[model samples]
Target: MSARAALATALDRIERYDEDIGALLEVDAAGAAARAAELDRSESHGALHGMPFVVKANMCIEGRIASCGSRMLEGYRAPYTASAVQRLIDEGAVPIGIANMDEFAFGSSGENSSFGSTRNPWDLSRAPGGSSSGSAAAVAARMVPFALGSDTGGSVRQPAALCGVTGYKPTYGVVSRHGLIAFGSSLDAVGVLATSAADVERVLAVISGADERDATSALRAPFEPAPARTDLRGLRVGLPREYFPADLDGRVRQPLEQALDDLRRLGAELVELDLPTTRHAIAAYYVVATAEASSNLARYDGVRYGARIAGDGSLQGMFAATRGAAFGAEALRRILLGTYVLSSGYYDAWYLRALKVRRAILRDFQAAFERVDVLAAPTSPTPAFRLGEKLSDPLAMYLCDVLTVPTSLAGLPAISVPCGCAAEDGVELPVGLQLIGPAFEDARVLSVARCYQAATEHHRRLPPLVAGGVA
Candidate 1:
């Protein structure tokens, strides 16, 4: 199909369905339509020619609204596009709009967005795991073929799990962070959300490479697509004991067991492994992420870009007023916590210790890799919870990422593939089987996911909200 046709379909769905999903914060239908028309007229473009996709609010696309789900930059228009996104646009992927996210990518539930929560496509009452909520939801709803999301701590994978899509977080620095609005700099990674692991791999190949603009971008060769695997012969899959807690819901566990069985039937040897440092993953991740966030966000003062509150004609008062009015409750909470951890007296006790724990987590993954080619786990502690379910309880919300933060801390590659559904009261919620790989082994992760998807119909199932889908 032509880019114009694809875009028209997406725009039609956005109009017909967005009212219920709340996945998009802004829709650039006109801009995308123009781009699609030009691409159709052009004799030659690039790979992904005429593809329609959305970018999370945090990823800057030159001249597009990039609010990062916070009121602070409510109408901010980026001067330059993010490196990863620009690569997609260059490859002929047309960006339709900015997908909603947790405010400053701070929360696990999409409800934290200042713009409003992005509801799950499977069930409107349930939350779309965030802060990549809209990215996952949009793809699941079939509004777009793919979306660009930033995963600081399973933001992309967790949402994809809840929404039943393929979400991939590449090894750190595989994609440049040039124009991604800062949030947990070290842990933050530009990720992809698509219908399947194969689709995710296609997008990754185009965008994965070194960029001169980003100092942290790896000096590596362009990503080469991998051959599709029909079977996981000789593949060693590790099952971490921590990932399956005793309190896990049977509805979720049942589907997981089925997925593991599928892997085994595909010739994968599932090996039980132990990573003791998994217990400290959450604690270490929060500390490191918040500390970096505090430093990265400090630049959003009244004197520069974004919202400003001129208070009492004083610099300090204006700063406080501007921040207080612009930042949401969750953003403020993180800022305070981050600041406290980085403070002089407590830096060693909190921030430094977190760094030590981070190292330990990385080592743990290294040790596991010696015995297994990939690690499998639940992407989120539970299936998509009710929208307001854990909003009032931050601890409960944090635990949602318990199964994902360890990989983020280790800076390894991970992808969440839809396993199956957890049948509930008149609604079928999806569960995800997460595959983690050693650092820089993204292709392996994608290959395994593709093999699993080839053998299962999970990724083929569309959300109820999408037309003709059986949920």
Candidate 2:
């Protein structure tokens, strides 16, 4: 099929099925079709020519409303395109719409999105691990072939794992963050979600280099094709003891063990590695993420870009009313927590101490990388949970990042590829095998994921919902 045809089909799927899945907050059919027509007429198209994709609402996409899943910016529109989105468009990709996410990318269950929760296509009632919830769900549902997401603390990888798709968070600075609405500025990185590793690579290649607009972007390096090695003969794979918690679900554990056996058979050398600070990753991640968020979000004071509430007479009234009316309960909670932690007399006690712990975690990962080429673990301790599962308890929601947050905090590359399905209540739930690599080693990490993917058909399976069948 031509790129236009494929996009048309995807659009049809979105219109027909997204109401039930709640994966997309917006769908720009006319915009996508216009781009598709342009691509069809252009003779000189690049790698992503005519490809259909989605951007998380947090990323600016020109005319699209970059709400970031918060009511605060419910009717807001971007004045300019996100650099990453623009780069993809230049390469011939058509952005179909903006995917749903947790409000300001705060929660893990994806239940916190102000728009509504994006269901795991594998199990409609189950939560799609978030805050990249809709990015993963849309790709899994084939509403779009690939999508863009932002990860601060396991957002991309966790959701991808839950949805049974490939999601990769590149090393910090490898991809430009110019258009991405900041959550945890230093920790947030734009990432890709797709059905296969090859698709992820295709999108990454087009947007990986540095941009003058984003000082943190990595400088362009000479093109080097990833080594094609299916065999993991000399590759050192580490199994971090801290990742396997005592309360891990037995159902998920079985498939994880089977994956280890499969990896061993593929010739990878299994090594027991100790990342002692892994236990502190979740705590450190929340502290650092919220602290940075508190600062970055100060810009949305209604005087600048987003929604504004009418005040009685004073400037103080305007600010208070705007924030009070614009933000959701969850968004307000994070902002308040973040502000308090960074306030005088509390900075050293909370934010500063969290930074110290974060440094120790990074050091631990660096020390482990000296011994192992990649770290392996189950992306989540369990598969998707029922909707409204952990929404009531903040700490419960935070714990969902246990297996995925450490790699994120250290600014390393990681990929989540479906390994197998665990049976729960007579329904099969997808299991994801996560691979962590040293910073700037995205190719190596993806290469390992591809090897695993080639040996297993887990990632190839799609949720039945795309065809309007029961999940």
Candidate 3:
């Protein structure tokens, strides 16, 4: 289909179905049409020729409102596009809109988004896990064929799992971070959310090179696609004993075990691995992420960009008012926690210790990778929960990331693909199995994901809104 036609279809779906899903924070139907028209006649179409996609609200797209789903930047417009977004546009992909996310990408559940939560299209009352909530939901709803998301922790992978889509987070520094509004700089990575592994691989191919603009960008590496077949004759898949806790629901465990069985049948050698430091990953992740957030977010002081408070008699007053009014309760909570962790005397005790723990976690992954080609675990302990189910308890929200955080800390590549569904309350919630690869081994991660996806039709199931309609 032509780019214009694809965009029209996306816009029609947005108009017809977005109201109930809340997947989009902004939809530029006209803008997208114009871009598609421009690409339609280009002599040399790039990899994403005339493709339409959504970007997480946090990533800047020139002239568009780049609200990070927070009151602070509710009406903020981007002065320039993020390098990742720009790369997509250059490749002939048109940005259809910006999707909702957890405020400042701080929450694990979509409910934390100040614009309102993005509903899991599978079950409206359930969350489309966040802070890549809208990115995952939009793809699941078929509002767009693919979308861009950022992962500081499990922001992209967790949501992709819950929404039954493919979410791939590249190794840190593999993708340019020049325009991604910071959450945890060291851990953050630009990710892609799409319907299949091939789509992800295509998008990543175009945007995965070094950029002088981003000092952290990795040196360019040749794009080599993983072998298409899943004859993992010599591939060793590691299963960490810690990932399956006693408290794990049977609905989640059964499908996960079945997925492992399928891998075994496909000739993957299953090896039991121990990541003892996994117990401290959640606490360590929070401490490290918030500390980095404290530093990265300090720039939004009303003096430069974003929402500014009016009628300030002094500079301090302006800064205080702007942040006070712009930031939401959750963002404020993170800022406070971040500031406290990085504060003068406490930095050594809290922030420094977290760094030590982070190193330990990385070491654990390094050790395990020596014995296995890839590590497998349940992406999330349970499937999507009701919208407000865990919002009241911050720790509970943090716990949802247990299986995904260790990989983030290790700066390894990971992909989450739906394995099956969990039967609970007479309903089946999606279950995602996560595959973690060594640093710069994104191809392997994608390869394993595609293998599993081909072996099962789990990822092929569409959410109700896309398969049928809102009942």
TM-score for each predicted model, relative to the true structure: 0.98, 0.97, 0.97
**Candidate 1 vs 3: which has more TM-score:** 1
Error of 3 at 113 (Å): 1.5
> What is the per-residue lDDT of model 3 for residues 1-471, given as tens digits with 9 covering 90 to 100?
789988888898888778999999999888988889988887888888888999999999999979899887878999999998998999999999999999989887888888889999888889999999999999988888899999999999999999989899998888999889989999999999998888899899888889888898898773456879856678899999999777787878998999999999888999998999999999888889888887888888888777888647788888888888888877787889999999999999999998999899999999999999999999988899988889888889998899888889889999998888876676668888899998999898888878877887888888756687421
Q: In model 1, what lDDT does residue 292 have?
A: 91
Candidate 3, residue 140: Cα displacement in angstroms equals 0.5
Two-way lDDT contest, 1 vs 3, winner: 1
- Predicted structure with the largest lDDT when compared to the true one: 1
In model 2, the runs with Cα more than 4 Å from the true position are 222-225, 467-471
**Model 1 lDDT tens row, 162-199:** 99999999999999999999898888899999999889
- Best to worst by lDDT, what's the order? 1, 3, 2
Go through the candidates in order and give each one's C-alpha lDDT: 0.91, 0.87, 0.88
The lowest-lDDT stretch of 10 consecutive residues in candidate 3 is: 462-471
Assess candidate 2 and give its TM-score to the true structure: 0.97
Model 1, residue pairs in steric clash? none
lDDT of candidate 3 vs native? 0.88
